[model samples]
Target: MFISLNVKFDLFYSILAPNVIPDGFVDGRQVTEKLLEATQLDKNLYQCGNTKVFFKAGTLAHLEDLRDDKLNGIISLFQAEIRGYLMRKQYKKLQDQRVALTLMQRNIRKYLVLRNWPWWRLYTKVKPMLNIARQEEEMKKAAEELAKLKEEFEKLEKLKKELEEQNVTVLQQKNDLFLQLQTEQDSLADAEEKISKLVLQRGDMEQRIKELEERLADEEDQAANLNEVKKKMSSEIEELKKDVEDLESSLQKAEQEKQTKDNQIRTLQAEMAQQDETIGKLNKDKKNLEEQNKRTQEALQAEEDKVNHLNKLKAKLESTLDEVSLWTKWIFFNIFHSLL
Candidate 1:
């Protein structure tokens, strides 16, 4: 029965190693080492007889030549190694399958919970809160509208009161101004009546003054004429006095002329002697004129010499002017050449 168990173990190991074993079974450090060592051994080597002996061999010739005890021992050892490798691989595969199935179950449970979560939260928690928030918003809007209305009402009341006061003030000021205007009108009428009376009195005074001015002008003219008449009378009296003195002087001169006629007869004899003396003086003056004519000819010769000297000076001035003109022409020619 032990040998049969050993054969079954060998068959199981063969199937597990080639087909049934999972890759994760050899992932551990210790199991990987054993798997690698077993893979290196010759697959054809075996131990077949009772109390088998093992061999390390690769070719069929080497395996066939091995002693029966060595061959059987090698086969049994290989079978044991293969059994241990397959058991560990099966255990690791079962563990991984268990873990995969558990994870799948957990994911299924999470999917179910998430799928219902929103509906539960909305019905149980959020609906009532949203309704309360909407009510609060409406109440806030209504309160704001009420506040605005109240403020407008107060402002309107204040404006109405101010308008009433302004109307009363205007009416009072109008009444006072009307009374003052009436008083001013009465005073203006009295002043106008007084001005009219004064204007009449002024006209009468102006007429009297005009009449007095005319009378005064006439008296001044009469006085001026009287003064002129007095001046003329005084001048006539002076002329009459002068005429009397002339008449008296003429009467004295007539008496003196009668006495001078008597003296003229004596003077006529003295004049005949003086005429003879005058003829001798005339002959002496005629001889002096003939000497003066010779001296005048000598003075004329001296004046002619002065005239010739003045002519020579005028010729020298003309020569100097010609030289100045030539020099001016030369200077202008030189200046024009330098500029070009």
Candidate 2:
């Protein structure tokens, strides 16, 4: 987000009054603060150059890396968005200064015309000159005001960049969440397979225990031996049940993780949808601003034509005023000589 205030200051001063040039430095920091005041943007969010302000400089540069990743024009969109915003800011600042300068010129012309009044009292004649001086002061004030406005314009521009970057950041987060959800789902599927195998093993153990019980019932004469066999089988059955329990616990944990992932995915989806809405609104605003810029350009061009006409008229008036002063001075000289 960079703004360039490239006014021809030298030409401006020469046109206003050849011998007078206003002295001041363009306080980039003060201008930046003023531009961001309404937006409440932090100073760290941007950097100010002599005529340019850059926003999210590092982030913007990082985005260029996406060009080879086939992310499909998103990076370009961000660039164009910022560029358009800068252009709009520039146009607005120019429009404001143009209006102020036009008004000032008109006021100066009024003073000049009044100063030419041939029958006015000495005090009355002096008053117009004083007013002219005052108007010059007002012109200086107007320049200062223009600088403030330029900064204010930057505030809006900074907000625009922040909003767009936020949308991009949200999208990146959503993609990461989606990948996590996929991994959780795959883990859940593996857990389900392990649980199915455990259930089949438990069924096999139950069948073996039933067979051992029938054998012991049929061989009471070898009751001690059968008792030993039943004890051994029971131990094996207990071990299988423990294995099944562990598998069940593992399955439950996997299911819990899957549920958590699903919840996160849903939440991120909601945020992405909201961001989409915001981006849409911003796109609309961009269109409106473009239209406004077109109109402003046309208006500015018309104003330039009017200013040229006025300047030509002013030149002729100044020439006539110079001739009138010479005639007045010559007549006074002749009268003084006659009296002597």
Candidate 3:
């Protein structure tokens, strides 16, 4: 009797999956580690060494079974892809065969059933020419429609170009308007600053006017005091005149009894003249103060007018700024709406 023995090789190497090993990797220990890490196999079944792996008695068998399953799964995936492609090819062939068979059946039925009829035979003989004429007419109509479509397309293209140009112009205008708005805003800020400065100046002017008025009041008080002093001097002059008259009467009655009487009279007259000169100077000073007060009032009036003018100017500028802002808003709204 002859006996044949079949032996399977590689109990340990078979456990490494083909997909786990990189190209040019030949080290057994690295391959074992990669396979173990990739597969996450139970550590109790195998031990890793410096250059080899030791497996328990049944571990090699189990790993080989797992490798076989993985290989089978890859084979099955390839088989499914090939089978799907073949099935699609076969389905297309079957569809063509079915259409050809249907066409042949229709032709056989027509030949067997209608071949003997005179009208059918005549129609068959004339059908090609009639079909040709009809196709020619349809072709003519199609050509006319195509020409019309070409003309319409050209018109649409021209219109699109014109619209694009208009849009560009509108965008340019919008940019110009935006720049104008920015300039207006800058001007408005400057105007506000000027107005603020004017307001502060107005306050200063008012304060100065107030100070002038107070000074004028003080001058009036000093003039009243001078008038009182003048009145006291006039009373003393009247008393001195009366005393001179009495002394003259006594000199006449005593006839040269008081020889110094003439000297006292002369002194009294000189004092009167000095008092008159002082009165004249006081009147001139009062006139000067009156003129100064008048000038001060005129200056205050001018300042008030200046303040009024500045207020009017500020209002006008504010109105203009408001109008510009409104116009800018309108332009922005219109531009945005048209773009949308």
Candidate 4:
């Protein structure tokens, strides 16, 4: 077919080779590599000449030259080419056009069925709503996760507060235990001092009892000597006999006083024995307290509940010690009264 000297042969070549023109009758001769090369060369030459036409090198834009040609001449040449091709094909082009038209109609029907156009139009209309629903679901899941994290954080904070309270309670308990221990130690010291005083009092009472015994022995010796003197003077004179009788009465009185003193000594010994028993009991109690103190020291590192129990035990022990101290004092007073 005839073509304009300046037609975009390269454009036809580039498009037809990629099958973009669909049913166009393009062939190897019309879209040759040589034709494309010539078209690119002409564009570059025209560009170098600085012509008024705007065309890119290495492309079919060289066809801009056809725009300067007479419009009637182009139409006449295009018609002549069409008439020559149609004369040779007779009605074959029409038949081919009819077939192509039928194929296009069938393809259009298949596309409509496959795409489901009515449903596609509905989908296009509701797509934003579906997207919004999906976004809402994602937002809900994120909110749930955030809430769960916040709950966990609150639990951790509560646990931290509980631990702080426990720490404060433990410190308070430790201080209380320290004060109680100091008080108990002071009480123990006082008890020991009292016990020492009791021991000194016991020694003084024993010494006094020894001196009284010695005096009683000396009085007995003097009474024996007077009895010998009375025997010697018995038949000497009535004066001497009267004198002996007086001395005998005095001796009898001295014997009665010695017996009374002996009774008092026995009573004092009994009181001393009671004092010893009391001291022994006190010593036992002190030992028990020492053991309990040792246990308390051992349990210093134990739990608060155990420390509280120990505190109660200490109070009971203190009460018992106070009772024991009162008993000891009463016993000491009675012993001293008897000695006096």
The all-Cα superposition gives candidate 3 an RMSD in Å to the true structure of 53.1
**Poorest 10 consecutive residues by lDDT, candidate 3:** 1-10
Q: Report how far residue 235 has shifted in candidate 3, in Å.
A: 36
| Per-residue lDDT of candidate 2, residues 1-340 (tens digit) | 4444333223321322323332332233443445344334566776665444566866334323432333446578888999999999999999999999999999899878777676543445334443444545554655555555556555656665666676577667655644554454456456556757756775776677567657655665556667777677667766766765775677577567657756765665566566566657766675665555555555555545555555565465556556657776998999999999
Error of 2 at 257 (Å): 3.8
Runs of candidate 2 with Cα error greater than 4 angstroms are 1-159, 187-225, 289-305, 320-340
Please give the distance, in angstroms, between residue 85's alpha carbon in candidate 2 and its true position after superposition.
24
Each model's C-alpha lDDT? Answer: 0.48, 0.57, 0.57, 0.51
lDDT of candidate 3 over 1-340, digit per residue (tens): 1111111112244445557776431334556667766667788777775424667787777766888887788899999999999999999999999999999999999899999997886565444543444545654655555555556555555555555555555545544543443344345445445545545554564565456556556666778766665555556555655655554454354433223444443444454455455545555555655555555555555545555555565465556556656766897999999999
Candidate 4 minimal-lDDT segment of 10 residues = 46-55
Measured on C-alpha atoms, candidate 3 has an lDDT of: 0.57
Superposed Cα deviation of residue 7, candidate 2 (Å): 49
Candidate 4: regions farther than 4 A off = 1-138, 224-340
Report how far off residue 320 is in candidate 3 (Å): 87
Sorted by TM-score (best first), the order is: 2, 3, 4, 1
User: Tell me, what's the RMSD of every candidate?
Assistant: 86.8, 21.1, 53.1, 63.4
TM-score of each: 0.22, 0.42, 0.30, 0.27
Which structure is stronger by lDDT: 1 or 3?
3
Task: Determine which window of 10 residues in candidate 1 has minimal summed lDDT.
Answer: 1-10
